[model samples]
Target: MKQTVEPVLQDKFERRFLYLRLSITDVCNFKCNYCLPDGYRPNGTKNSSFLQLDEIQRVVSAFAHCGTNKVRITGGEPSLRKDFTEIIASVAQTQGIEKVATTTNGYRMAEHVAQWRDAGLTHINVSVDSLDANQFNAITGQDRFKQVMSGIDRAFEVGFKQVKVNTVLMKDLNDYSLPQFLDWIKHRPIQLRFIELMQTGEMDDLFARHHVSGVSIRNRLIAQGWLLKSRQANDGPAQVYYHPDYLGEIGLIMPYEKGFCTSCNRLRVSAMGKLHLCLFGEGGLDLRHLLTNDDDQPALIEFIQQQLETKKVSHFLDQGNSGATPHLASIGG
Candidate 1:
C-alpha cells in the first residue's frame, strides 16, 4: 500500500518522463471500424493473456518510484472492466502520483462517473467521433451516442473539471462535423482535441482515402470566424490553440504531418504490460515478466531505463511506400 512516488529523471531526454498511459485491457466493448475491422475477432485463448490487476499495481508503483507522476488508464474502453474503479483508486493512492486519468469511449460513464471521482480519478477523456447518432453508429458500430452524451454530462456533474473530448477526424467521414462539435464546447471549459487519423489495423485504405491534417482542420475553423491563438503555457503531445472570445481550448494532434519526437516525453504500457517507447514502434519491453520474476525494484528500473535509451526519436510512415508500418490502434493510439 505504498503511496505514489515521483518519477525519477531518466537520461533519454532533458525532461523527466512522468506520464504513463496504462492500457488495462486490450478487449474493447465497441467495435469501432477504425480501431477494429469488421471481421476481427480474438485469435488466441481468452485466458492466455491480459495482465492481472496486482501485476498492474506493481508495475505502476515501480514507475512511480522511478519519478513517474501521472498515470492514465486506457483500454479498448476502460470502463467496461469490472474492477476499473478499484484500479483508479489503487493508482491514485500511490504516494507521488499527482494525476490519475482515464480515457474511455463514454458508453458506460454515466453510471460510474461519480464512483470514479470518489475513487480519486482526476480527469476523463471521452472519445466521440461524430455528434450525429447515425454517423457515430457507422463509425463505432454502436448505437450508443445518447448514452455517451449522457456520460459527458454526468462527468461534468461529478466535478471532473478537466474533461476532454477526443475526436479522430477522418476525411469525408466526420471531418465536416468539426465546427459543429466545437460549437457544442464553445461555452464549456472542456478541451476538444482533433486527432489526425493514422494508418493502423484495418483502416489503411481509410487513412489513404481520407488523410486530413490538423492544419486543414484549423484553417477550416479559422475560415468560420474561429480565431485560434496559441497558448503560452501549453505542454503534452497536443498542439493547443484557444480562441480569445471562446471558453474552451482546442488541441490539434497531427502526428503524421508534423513530428514531435524531439519533445516527446510520453511512454505507453500496453494492456499486457509491454513498454512501448513510440506509438509506431514494433517492439516493447515485457514489464509483466519483470513483475512476476520478483519484487526486484532496481532490476525493473534498470530495464525501463534501458528501453528508454533505445527509444527512437520519432516515427515516419509514408503512405506511398511499400513497407509502411501498421495502424495506430494496434500500437495503442
Candidate 2:
C-alpha cells in the first residue's frame, strides 16, 4: 500500500522528509521561562477547532504514504488533552508509521505514562529544565521536580528502553549546571538533550538575556571523549553523542548552527491544521478543510508537495528575524 504513493516528499534542495511533527493542541500547562514564561492563555475561541482524531489519521496517512516513517505528536503540552492516549493510538496504528513519539511536561506522568505505553507509544521526551527543585520551580513556574523525576523512573519500570530529557540551556540559569546533568545521566539510560534558547517573535528581550551557545558545550563534549552518533533518515535535528563509560547519552539541539537546515528532514502541521514549512517561517497554509474527507488524499498530498517548493533554504534567526513564531508553544517547538 505504501508503494502506491505517487512521489516521495522532497523539496527543491533534494532534502527528502521522512519525519512529521504534528501538533495536536497548542495549549500548555507549564510556564517555562524560555517558552511560556507567563503561562498558557487561550487564543480567543480557536481552542475547539484543533484537529480531531479522524483528521489526525488522514494527515498521518498522507504523510506515511509520502514515506514518513516517524511521527511525533507535539503540543504546548500534548498530554493536557483528555484523549491524549487515543491520539497516540490512532497515530501508531496508521499504516507505514513505524515510530510514535511525544514530548510532554511530565505532569502526572507517573499516573499516565503506563497508559500511554499501552496505547502504542514508542518514545517519550520529558522537559526538566533544571535538576534543582528550587531552580526547576523558578524556571518552569512549577514545584513538580520530584514528580518529573518519578515519572522518568516510571517510564523505565514500564519497559521503555530509553527516555530523553530536554533541558533548555539558558545563560546564568541552567548553563552552569551541565556537570550535574551529566552525572544524573551517567548511570541511567537517559539521553540528556541540551537545547539552545531560540528567539521567537514575542520573546526578544528574554532571548537576548538568556540565550546560550551550544557550540561551546559541543566542543567540551568532544574534548571529554564523547563520540558523535550519525543521524538516521527519520531522526530529528539533535546532534547525539555517546560515551563508553557512561550508560546514558548527550544530545545538542542548536538551531543557530551553520548548515543546520541542510539536514532538515521533517515538516510541521499546526494543531489548527495549517502546514508550516519552517518553524520560523512567515506563515502557514490552511490544510484543515482538505483533511475532512477521505477522498481528498490526492489533493492533500498534491497541496503539500506544491507548498514544499516554497520552503526557504534556511531560517532568518541569524538576521534577528523570528517570523511568525510568537512562542514555542504555539507550534509545539
**Highest-scoring model, lDDT:** 2
Worst 10 residues of 2 by lDDT: 1-10
Residue 104 error for model 1, in Å? 0.4
lDDT of model number 1: 0.76
On residues 115-221, what C-alpha lDDT tens digit does candidate 2 reach at each position?
99999999999999999999999999999999999999999999999999999989888899999999999999999999988999879998899898999999999
lDDT of 1 by residue, 1-333 (tens): 999664464645554577888887766767776677562355363623667777778878888887787888887667767898999999999877888988888988899899999999997888999999999999888899999999999988888776798998887888888668777887988889888777664566877888787778878767766654553311457777777767887888877665556667667887767888777776667877688743666787888887777765567554343122243334356
lDDT score for candidate 2 against the true structure: 0.92
Q: Tell me the whole-model lDDT of each prediction, alpha carbons only.
A: 0.76, 0.92
